[model samples]
Every structure is written in structure tokens, then in C-alpha cells.
Target chain A: MNRQVLLFYPLLGMILLGLFIGGLAYGAVPIPLDHVVDILLGKGSDKIAWQNIVLQSRLPQAITALLAGASLATSGLLLQTLFRNPLAGPSILGISDGANLGVAAIMLYFGGTLGQFADWPISGYMAVILAAFAGACAILGLIIYFSAKVKNNVMLLIIGIMIGYLASSVISILNYYSSTDRVHAFVMWGLGNFSGVSLEQLPFLGSCTLAGLLLAILLIKPLNALLLGEMYAANLGIHIKRTRILILLCTGILTATTTAFCGPISFIGLAVPHIARLMLGSSNHKMLVPVTVLTGSCIALLCNMLMVVPGSNMILPLNAVTPMLGAPVIIYVIVNRKNIQYFN
Target chain B: MAMKQTSVIKTSDLSIGYTLKGGRKKCVHDALNLSLYPGEVTCLLGLNGAGKSTLLRTLCGFQPPLGGKIELMGKPLSSYSQGSFSRMVGVVLTEKTNAGGITVYELASLGRHPYTGFFGQLRQEDHRIIEESLIAAGIAHKAHNYVSELSDGERQKAMIAKALAQQCPIILLDEPTAFLDVTSRIETMVLLHKLAVEQQKAILLSTHDLDLAIQLGDCLWLQEKGRPMACGTPEDLILGGAFETFFSKEGIVFDPGTGKLHTEAPTVPVGVEGDLTTSYWVGNALIRNGFKPSLVSEEYVSVCCNAPNDLRILFPVGDMRIAESIAEMVSIIVHKS
Candidate 1:
């Protein structure tokens, strides 16, 4: 690795650490950094409320941002490479929207009636996560099935868009028929959040994201080969069909898990890879994959900290802050795309 | 005898094309027998839509043949796994590579995918091979430069280096010279010819540059649409009339005497005689002027060899015109005739 590629990991790691500390320290309730560190170390924080805030609430939320950021960024990179489209993101295939549709079905149609859903296996928040996973994987499975039939990546992308459309249509119908309070509940979920995963839910979310990221790492070889296009990649002995399905599966699991807990977090997946590409000056995924993971966590942590409004008790929605960082980066990338070696 | 004993790739009664819906086979050509010997360059020449790409893709194992068998190193093409096949046959495609961000070294390293492990960590031996391949392809100077930073010809040389790095015994390319300028085209052809001889590898390339192909190819495969491909040495094919028949179209015919192609048969016949250099150019002008030039013709045109300036053109009308150049001579012949 050159100087730029070698320096990226540590630089992004430090930035991520600072933002993570900021996320833990500066919430709606102001907790000092030292106390936050003390609480994290299991030392008494001088107040019970601060302890509850630090140990139970902010820690999981910060970790959620970290994991979700990495997962989404990894998915975005995979989709962009798989489809060979620079603008492709986690939500492009409607997998996250599928998760949104699932949440809509739960909040809008079922109204989260624990008694009504008690006949089923899971309940409450668990039901929502399960439903979101089901919905996302359902669309993913559909795409994989069609991927076997459709030889063209652009065609498969169109098929993904159509499936996303179908999922959205169902969500709209569910939203339309619901009561006013239920629609508000569904809309609130649609606004997106990172603090949604509780202390108990972190392990499940963490493992799924870990599995997906590990699979993505294992995929580094084929992904690098794909940079030469499909036919040439096939000539290099990379099995294109198996590799495509594995990529979809990996992107699906990561997107689905994050969307299940985090509510279709936008831009991080689509833009972080480009950000990593810009910083590293290379697209060889060996270093790129790790750099993207670190940069993603940093961006997510930064965005998580920004979601906290200063001085006032008001908190900005996570979605509202991501595009502020993500959109401009994407625009800059688009305008100068020809000059960027990644696009070439 | 050594070439027959050491054929790298041999196809027996091969048929290639697409298989349409409902198991319908849209065969482009069938009953083809071909062999590529080590240390030789075989250039496949054909018209547009002659399925050159299809045949190449089939040979590269990117697609299956509609019928027949391809044997690489005496083993069935189907018997070798993808990894083994890759280690045996290196391929350079017609499309431009999208590996712009990676360095030329990285791009060449991709050719070692079959040999590298899952992470594609290049071993010491692999690195040595890649460097040697780069040097062999004449791209060692730009080894550290980005692929996007290279010129078109350099980029093509880099891609060829990538295929070379595969360390395969047989290298196949489809339209390798299609995107290159005349100089780069000749350079790439010469490089392939050198690789075939120096590396002792069997190299087959499809190209539209017939003049270059004829000059460089050790063997030529002429594929016409829906017809069995013709394969032979360029001299043998030209002598046996395969070249003439394959390229036979309106207003053009293959000239066996010059072993090149020329335009339509002329209306008038004229005799021309001079030194080889002057006579050839003088005859070229006659052919373009719709007049046939031969030594045995009723109407005569002759070049005076001893004239250094103000070259003399003898017309059949018994008038001698002094011309400075072939261009001026042709203009005078048009005006006088």
C-alpha cells in the first residue's frame, strides 16, 4: 500500500473514535466525556440518571451507528460494483424500502397489537425486526431468482426497481387504510433512527452485520476481478454466477439488518465507498473494503453526533442529517465523475 | 513434425453459435476442424457478424459450443475446471478494461487469480512471473503508473501484459487491433508474433487488418457466415483460392499474384514494363484508372527506367508524355486516353 492507502485506516479510526465519544457525551442530556468513560468502565457516574443514559441508552445507540454505518457502506460498495453503476446504493434495490414496507405493515396494518400478534411467534419490536428482515429478504430472493434468468446487470437493476415499486405500493395501501394515530406511528418509523436498537437487540444486529462484512471480505478477490467487466472476470476464473449471487446475498443481509433496526438509513452506503475511493486514490477492494468500513463508521458516528441539536432539547432525525453530508459528496462525485479514476 | 506433435489446442468437428429459446440451436458454423500449434500465431479473419467473437468466447470457455469438442493440451475443454482452464488459456477481450484506479502492476496481478489464494495474495513466484510478463509485453516502464494514465497503445500493451501474466501456454485475443491506430496495430501484431515465438506459446487472434494478418500470421482461419471455416497457411490458402472465395464481393477480388486484395476488373487492358519498383506503382495507377496492366496486352503503357526526373510515360497512341510523379503520370494517362 502507498502512503495514502496506509494512512486512511488510522485517520478514519481516530475520527470515528472522536465522533463516537461526541455521540456518547453530547446527547439531549449533557454528559461529560470523562463521566461517559467512567460509566463505560463500570465506575459510578455520580448520578443514576446519567448512568441510565450512558450505560443503557447512548452506548447502544453509538454502537448501532458504528455497525449500521459500516454495514450500509459495505452494501453500497458491493451494489455499485455488482451493477457496475456508480450511483447504486443499499436502498436502490428497494431492500431497505422492503424493510420500510414491512414496518408499515406492522405499524399501519397490525397497529402493533401485541395480543393480535400474540398468536404468532414474536411480539412488539421483535415482530417489526422480523417483518423487516422477511420483507427485505423476500425482495432479495426475488432479485436472485430473476438474476438467474436475466443475464444483464442493468436489466436486473430495473427488476430490482420494479420490485421496490411493488413493495412501496403495498406500503402505501397499508398507510392509506390505517387510523390517524397508526399512520403517525408508521411515518415516525419512516423518518429513520439509529437509537432504535436496544441493549438487548445489539447482539443480533451485530452478528448479522459481522457475517455480512466477513462475507464481503471473502468476496474481495472476485470483486477485484469484476473491475475488469464480466467476460474478462470469467476469463480470470472467477465464477461470475456464484459470485453474483453471493454478492447479492451479502448486500441483502447487511441492508436488511440495518434497515430493520435503523429505518432505511440513507447515503452512507452509497457515498461512503466513493469517499473511501477519493481518499485512497484506488479502487482495488483489498484496501478499499477496509477503508470503506472505517470511513462509514466515522461518517455514521459524525452524523449521529450531529443529530443532537446544540443547547436545545430538540434532536434532529437521523435521515435529516445524513443527506446534508451525503448529498453534497454525491453531487461533487457526480460532477467530477469523469476525472475520478474509479468511474473510468 | 514438432508442430503436429505439439498442438496446443485442437478442435474436432466443432460447431459454435447461440442456443435460442426452446432448445433451438442457431448454429453459425459446423463441422470445423482446427489446430493451433505452439510457437505460431493464427489470425482469424472474417466479415462482420461472422461469429468471430462467438467462436472466441466458445474457445475461452465463456460459453459452451453448440456441438463438437475442444481439446486444450489433449484434454477435453469440458474436463478442465475453470481454474485449470484459466491456467492454460489466457484471454484478452475486445472491450476496454475498466480497471482505471488500479496500477498496471495491479491489473497484471489480476491475471494470477487462478494461482493466488482466496484473498489473491500474490506469492513471490507470482510476482516474479508478473514482472517478467510485463517486461515481455514491453510495458515494464509503466508498471507503477495507473492504467488510466497510459496511452491507448500503452493501455493495450498493459492488457496484453495482463494476459501474459496468466502464464498460460495458449493466449487468445478477440479483435486485439480493432481499437488501435495503424502504428499501434502493427506494434501489437508484432508483439503477439514475438510472444508466440519467444514464449513458445500458441497464440490465436481475430482481426480485420488483413494486410497485417497476412504478413504476420503463421496460419489463417477464414470464417464466413454460416460456412465451415477455412484454415491453412496464408500462402497455401491464397494458392488454393480460399482467400479469393472468402473475400469475393462486388467490385473487389483477391489478387494471388501480389497476395493482396485489389478492386474490380478493369474495362481496358494495357501492357506495362519497367523495373519492379516503377512497374508496380505504374500498374497500381492503371488499375485505379479502370485499365488492366499486364506485359501481354494489345494496348501498351511503359515507364522509362533510366529517367531520374521528368519520368516518361509511353501511351498506346504512340505519344510519349513527360511526368514528374505517379500522380501526374496517372493524370496524363487519363487526359491522353
Candidate 2:
């Protein structure tokens, strides 16, 4: 690593640490910073209720926000590089739409309920997660199959967009057929929240997102090679087809895990990579990927904190809060594309 | 004969074409024998749709030849694995790269992919090779600049550096000069020539710039549809009249003396009397203005090139016009006629 990156990480590390702690201490209930630290250390809190809220609720929510943000951001970076298109993201590939389709099937078609099948009662949360995973895997499988058949990356990207449209069409149909109550539930889920994962669910969210992040780290070389474009990458002895499949696998895992837990959170996957690129002034991926991961975590924790700035009683939907931060970056990128050194 | 300068790449009775899904084939060229020698620049010149790119793709093993065989270093092309093939041949294609945000140094370092570890970490030697490539390609000054910030010529040089860093024995380029301006085009050709001699690497490129090819190419391959391909030294090919009938068309003529193509135009005979250099340019302007040079007196318009920039045209109608330059003389003579 170069000196700039070495310095960049610690600075970002400090910022991320600050955001993580800030998310824990500041909420609607107005818990003191000292009390939060004491509760974390298992020293009895003056108010036991505040302790439970901070430990069981705010801590898990903050970790979920951090992991999900990093996953989405890395996924965005991977997809953007793989397609050689600046606008590509996890949602652009229709993987998130696939996750939406899964949730729609559970909430809209199943009428907000899960039943026993084969004398086994499927829990609601596991069913939704499984459905989302299945949906994402299905889209990922289609992309991989098409990638093998189509030698052109641009064509594969087009096919992915078309597939995403198809999934959205199916989701629209499910929403149309559902009752008002189920539709409301589906809509609420669609608005997106980082609080869905409880204390018990943090391990699942953390492991899956970490695994996806690790896979992205492993792909740093191929990703950098791909920035040269596919033909040149292949000339460098990279198996273009294998690399494409691997990229889709990584993006699919990250998007699916985050969308499954957080209800198709928007903009983070599409915008964070651009932010990281602007900050680093490079597309090298070796340093870019790790920095993107950290920046994603910091942004997510900040957004999570903002969601409750109006107080716990008036929580902001994450989907609403993210676009405010993410959309402006995208607009700036589009407006000053020629001035961007990396944009061609 | 110094062992005839061992061939880097050779094709024997090769047939290349496009094969469709049902095994149907559309043959572009057939029965071809070609060889590339080390320390030489070979240019493949052809008209559009004449299969220059197809031949290049086949030679670099990007696509398979329909029939016959290709050998690299005396081994069948198919026998070499991907890793060894990359180590042997570097390719520079004409596709506009989207390698924005990547510094020139980083882009060149990618040529070390085949030699580096799984993560592509650049060792001390890798960095040295990359720096040397940058210097050789003459873009070392812009090593830290983003590729998108470089001009077309600089970007092309950067790509050339990347290929140099690959350290392959042979480099194949597909219309490397197609997008460059005249100066950059000649500079690129010169660079390739220097690289071929200094590195002793075999360099092959397909181009439509016949003038530059004839001037700079050590050897040439001329291809045209429905005609047998021609291959030889540029002088030999021109002397053998290979260029005269190449892509034969009604208004275009190949001048073997100058090794350039000229539009076939009607010329009126004119007598030229002056200093050799001045007369030569006046003759050129006359030809372009549809006049032919002749020594005849009657029925001929005489011209006097008094100095480098002075010209006097005496028309057949017994009219005289003095002009300062060839353009003014040609205009006066043309408008008067």
C-alpha cells in the first residue's frame, strides 16, 4: 500500500469509530455517552430500560447499518468496474429487484404470513431471508449463464437490466393483487429500515456481509485488470468469463444479504463507489476497495444516526435519508463528468 | 545467411474465415503462407473489409484459423497455454479504452499480471520493468497522470508502454495509428520501428495508411478481396507492380515512383521552364488543377516559376497572369480557362 492509502485508512478508521459510537449514544431517549459506555462494560445503568435499548436495540442496529452499507458500497464498486459503466449498481442488475420480488411474494401473495409445509412451520423471518436469497441467486445464475453465452460485457449488462425490468413487472403484479393491509406492509418494508435485524440476527448479517466483503477483497486484482476493459483483460491471461461470474457472485451476495435484512436499501450500492473514487482519485481497486468498504460503513452509521435525530418516536426511513446524501454525489458526477479524471 | 533470421510466427497454407453456429463457413482468405521475423516491422495494408483485422486476430490466437496451421517459435499455436501465449505475444488493439482514473504507471504495471502473484503485487523487478517501459515509450513524464487526462497520442504511447512492459517477443497491433493525427501517426510508426530494432522484437500491425507503410515498413503484406495476397519488402512489392492493381478502381491510380495513390484526373499539357525545385511544385499544382507538363509550344500553356514563391502563367489565349504562389497561379489559370 502507498503512503496516501496508509494515511487515508487510519483517518477513515477514526471517523468510522466516531460514527459507530455516535450511533450508540445519541438517540430519541437521550442516553448519556458515559452511561452508554458503562452499559457496554456491563456496569449497571441508572436506568435499566435505557441500557436495554442501547445494548439490545441501538448496538445491533448500528452494526447492521455499518455492515449493510459496506456490502452495498463494495457491491456497487464491483458492478461498476465489471460493467465498465459508471451507472451500474446492485439495483441496476435487478438483483435487488429479485429480492423485492421475494419479499413481495411473501408479503403480497402470502398475505403477510408463513405456514407449515411438510409438517414444519417455517418462521416468517427465515422464509423472507431464504426467499430473498433464492431470488437473488436466480438472477445471479441467469446473469452467469448469459455471460457465458454473450462475449460482450455491454450486452450482458443490457440483459441484466432487462431481467431487472421483468422482475419489477412481476413485483408490480403481486402488489396489484394484494389486499390493502398486506400492501401497506409491503410498502412499509419497501421504504427500508436498518432496524429489522435484531440482536439475535446480527451474527447472520455480519458473517454473510463479511464473507461478501472478503470475496471482494480477493477480487482486487481481476477488478483492476477489468478496468482496462474486457479484451485487454483477457489478453492479460484473465479468464474473462470466470471473472464475470465471480463478480456477479460477489455483488449478488452483498446485495441479497443487505436487501434481505434492510428491505432493498437504495443509493449506497450505486453511489458510494463514486464517492470513494473521487476521494482517492484512482480506480486501482487495491486501495479503492478497502477504502470504499470503510467509507460505506461510515456513511451508513451516519445515516442510521440521522434516522433517529428527530427522536426515536419519529424515525426516518433509511431509503428517504440515503438518497439525500447519495443523489447529490451522483448528480455532481454526471454534471462534471468531463472534469472527472477517471471518467471517459 | 545467419540462419535466415528465425521466424517468430509462421503460417502454412492457412485458411481463415468466420464459422457460424451450424458449422457453415464464410472464407475471407485462403492458402496463405506468412512469416514474421524478429527485429523487423511488418505492416499489413488493405482496404476496408479486406480481412486485415481478421488475419491479425488469427495470428494473435484471438480467433482460430479455419484450416491449416500457425506456429509460434516452431510450436503449433494451439499447443501453447494461455500463460505462455501471453508471455510470448502482446497485443495493442484499436478499441477506445475506458481506463480512466488509472495512472499511466498503474496501467503499465498491469502488463506484469502473468508474472505476479495472485494479488498482482508488484515486486522490485516488476516496478523496474514498468518504469523502463514508460521511458522506452517516451511517456515517463506522464507516469503519474491519469490516463483520461492524456491526449490521444500520449494515451497511445501509454498503451504501447503497457505492451512493452509485457516483454513479449512479438507485438501485434490493430490499426494503432488509425485515430492519431499525421504527426502522431508518423511518430508512432517511428516508435514501432525503434522498438523493433532495439528490443529485437517482431512487430506486426494492420493499417490503412499506405503512404506511411511504404515509407516505414521493412516488409509489407497486401491483401484484397478476390485477389491473391502479396507479401514482400515495400520496394520489391512496388517494383513488382503489386500496388498498381491493388483494389483497382476507376478514378484512382497508384504511383509506383512515389509509392502513393493519386486520383485519376484529366490533365491539359503545359510547358514548364524554371528552376527544378520551383518547377516541381508548379508541376504538382498544375496536375492538381488538371494540367499536364509538356515541352510543346503551340496548344500548350507555358508557365515560368521565377523563384520559390513567384509564378507567371502564359495562357494559350496569349494572356499573362503574375501570381505570388502556386494557389494563386492555379486559381488564375483555372478561372481564366
Candidate 3:
């Protein structure tokens, strides 16, 4: 690695750390920076409510934002590299849409309850999460099977989008029949919120997200080879079919887990990889992957901080804040793709 | 015309084509016998849709053959695993793969995957080999430049350097010079020829440039739509009357004297005499201007070149014209006749 790339890691790391702290300190309650530091150091604040808000609410939200951001961004980078298309992302293959369809089915069709379908009683958050996982895996299985049958990448992408459209049609029909209260609940979930995961849910969410990230790191060599295209990668002794399947599985898991925990957060998975590539000026995954992970965390935490920056105690949804930061970069990429070095 | 005692790839009665899903076979060329030798450049030349690319892909094991047997290094081509097969052969395809973000060095280093460890970390020896291959391909100066930034010719050299880094005994290229200009096309052909002779590697390539193949190719594989594939030395193919029949068209003929294509235009009889060098050019101008050289007669026109710059045209009507150059002489003859 060059000096510039080496410096990028720590620079992005420090920025992510700063944003994490910012996410914790700046919120609806407007806790002081020193007090936030004191709370993190385990020194109790004089006000019990401020301490609870900082430690229990903001801290977990910040961590969830960081992990989800990294997961979604890495997932985008993998899909982009795998498909050899810059527009590919976690949502492009319809795995995240499949998850959204599952959540819709749960909230709209089953009235947010699983007790009627099975002997074991389940409802609310746990049941919704399970259904999302099942739905994402189901779509992912179809994609994998089609990937084996079709050798063309563009054909597989089209198939994924068609399957997503099918799922969306079903979701729409379910929403049309559901009552107003259930429809309102589903709409809230669709708006997306990073603060949905409580302090208790962080451990399971963190580990699953990290495991997918680890698999992504292990895929660096093959991913770099793939940047040259599948024919060249296969010439270099890499198995194209096996690598394609593994990428689908990794992206599916990351998109499913993050959507299940945080409501299909938009734009991060599609745009953060481009941000990291533009920052690094190189697409060799050895540096791009880790930098993408760090940049994803920083952007997510920054967006999380922006949600309550007005201090009105009426926080904006994560989805609303994400497009403001991400859309401009995507537009810049599209306009200046020739000036930028992307695919040869 | 004599081949080396050892053969790297030998195929017997090989039928090559894509087999459809319903067991329908689309055979391109069948019942073929050919051998590729070390220290030689074998060029595949044919019209479009004649299965040149298919043959190259089959030999590289990218696709399976429809029938018959292919032996690489005296072993069945299918017996070797992908890892072993990659070590045995290196391929440079014509497809424009996007290698924009990777520097030339990193792209070349990927050739060492068969020998590198799991992470593909290059050792000091690997670096030395890569550097040597870059020099061999004449692309060492652009080692740090991104593949996308290089020109078409430079990107081709970079790919060749990558293949050289693989250290495989055989290198197969599908139209490596297809997108190059005249100078770069000749340069790439010369580079491949040099690599074949110096490294003693069996280098096979498919191309549409016949003049280059005629000059530099050690052996040529000629395929047509229905005729059996012909394989021989370039000289033998020309001398044995194979080039005449293979490349014949309605108005186009393959000239054995110049080994070039010529259009069969109508010829007017003319006679040329005088200085040997200028007379040769004057006769050439006659042929180019649809005139055939013959004995001088009262019924036809004749040209005489006494000096390099002076030309005299003698018409049977007894009209005479002197010109300063071949252009003026040919134009006067063309206007009168």
C-alpha cells in the first residue's frame, strides 16, 4: 500500500470514532459533551434520566448505526464487484426487498402476530425478525439456483429484480386488505429507524454483522481478481460459480440482519461503497473493503446524529436524513464517471 | 515445415462446437488432426464463423470438445484440474475486461495465483519474475499505470506481460491484435514471435491479419466453411496451392507472387521497354491501371522509360507523349486508351 492509502485507514477510523461520540452526545436531550464522557467512563450523572438516556438509548443506537452502516456498505461493495456493475448494491438483488415483503406480510396479513399460524406463540419484534430472515433467505435461494443455471450476470440481475417485483406485488395486495392500525405500523417500519434496537439486542446484532464482515475480509483476494471480470478471474485460477454464490449469501445475510433490526435503512448500502472508492481512488479490495467498512460507520453515525440535530425531541427518520448526504455523491459519480477511474 | 519432435497439444478427429440443451449438436469443424509444437508460432486464420475462436477455447479447456481426444503434454486435457491446467496454459482473450482500478503490477501479479498462497501474497522471487515478464513484454515502464489509463496497444502488452508472468509453457490468444492499429499490430505480432522463439513456448493465436501471419507465423491453420481444415508451414501452404483455393472469391484473387489480395480488373494491352528498374515500375503501373504488358504492335500502345524521371508513350496511331513521372505517363495512356 502507498502512504496515502495507509493514512486513509486511521483518518477514517478517527472520523468514525468522532461521529460515534457525536451520536451519543447530540440528541433530543442535548447532553453536554463532558457529561457524555463521564457517563461513558461509568461516572453517574447527577440527573438519573440523562444517564439512562445516554447509556441505554444513545449508546446502543450509535453502535447499531455503526454496525449496520458497515454491513450495508460492505454488502454494496461485494455486489458491485461481483456483478461488475457500479449500480449494484445490497438492495439491487431484491434480497432486502424480500425482507421488506416479509415484514409487510407479518404486520399486514398476520396482524403483527404469529400465534394463529403455529402452535408456539410468537408476536411483535421477534416474529417480524424471523419472518424477514426467512423471506430474505427464500429470495436468496432462488437467485442462487438461477445463478447456477444462467452463466450471464446481467440475466441473473434481471431475474432478481423480477423476483423482487413479484414479492412487491404480494406485499401490495396484503397492505390493501389490512386494517388502518396495522397499515400505520407497517408504514412506520418502512420509514426506518436506527434506534429500534435496544441495549439488549445489540449483542446478537453485532456478532452476526461482524461475522459477515469477516467473511467479506476473507474474500479480498478473490474480489480483487473479480474486478478484472469473471473470465480473467477464472483464468487466474478462481472458481467463478462458487465465488458468485458466496457473495450472494454474504450480501443476503448482512441485508437481512440489518433490515430486520433497523427497518431496511435506505441509501447506505448503495452509496457508501462509492464514497469509499472515490476517497481511496483505488478499487483493490485489500484497502477498499476496510476503508468502506470505516466510511460506512462514519456516514451512518453522522446521519444518526443529524436525526435529532434540531433538538425538538421529534427525531427525523434515518431514511429521511440518509438521502440528503448520499444522493449528491451518487449524482456526482454518475456525472463524472469518465473523470473518475471505475471500470476500464 | 518440419515440426519439433515433441508436441505440446495433439488433437485427433476433434469435433468442436456448442451442444444445445436438447442434445442437438452444432458442429463447426470435425474430423480434424493437428499438433502444436514448442518454439513455434501457430496462427489460426479463417473467415468469420469458421470456428477459430471455438478451437482456441477448446484447446484451453474453457469448453469441452464435442468428440475425439485432446492431449496436452501427453496427458488428456480433461484429466488436469483447473489449478494444474492454469499452470500449463495462459490465455489472453479478445474480450475487453474492465481492469481500470488495478495498476499494471497488481494485474500482472494475479498470474502467480497458482503458485501463491491463500492470500496471494507475492514473495521476493515472484516480484522478480513479474518484473522480468514486464520487460519481456516491453511494458515495464507502465508497471504502475492503471490498465484503463493505458492505450489499446499498451493494455494489450500489459495483458501479455501478465500471461508471461504465469510462466506457462503454452500461451493462447484470441485475436490479440484485433483492436490494434497497423504499427501496434505488427509490434504485437513481433513480440509474440520473439517470445515463442526465445522462450521456446508454444504460442498459438487467432487473427485476421493475413500478411503478418504469412510473414511471421511458423505454422498456419486455415479453416473455411465446408473444406477440411488445412495445416502447414506458411511457405508450404502458398506453394502447395492451398492459398489459391482457400481464399478465392468472385473478383478477388490471392496473388502467390506478392501474397496479397488483388482485384481482377479489366486489362488493356501495352508494351514496356527500357531501364530495368523504371521499366518494372512502369509495368506495375500498367497492371494497376488495368493495362497488361505485351510485345509492342501497331494496333496497341507501348511505353518506354529511358531515364528515371522521363517516360515516353508510343501509340499505334503514331502519337507520342513525354512525361516527367509515372503518374503523368499513366494518366496520358489512360486518357488516350
**Top-scoring candidate (TM-score):** 1
Instruction: Provide per-model DockQ scores.
Output: 0.77, 0.65, 0.59
Give one digit per residue, the lDDT tens place, for model 3 in B294-329: 666778988888986888888888988898999999
For each of the candidates, the C-alpha root-mean-square deviation to the true structure, in angstroms, is 2.7, 3.4, 3.4
Query: Which scores greater on DockQ, model 1 or model 3?
Result: 1
Reference-based TM-score of each model:
0.94, 0.91, 0.91
- Candidate 1: regions farther than 4 A off: A1-3, A113-127, A141-162, B1-3, B296-298, B305-310
Where does model 2 sit among the CAPRI classes? medium
**Chain A TM-scores in order:** 0.90, 0.90, 0.90
Off by over 4 Å in 3: A113-130, A137-163, B1-3, B263-288, B291-323
The CA lDDT at B13 in model 3 is 91
Candidate 2 clashing pairs, residues 3+ apart or interchain? A342-B101, B268-B292
lDDT of 2 at A148: 61
The TM-score obtained by model 1 is: 0.94
As for candidate 2, its interface RMSD to one decimal place is: 1.1
Pairs of residues at least 3 apart in sequence or in different chains that clash in candidate 1? none
Per-model tally of clashing residue pairs: 0, 2, 0
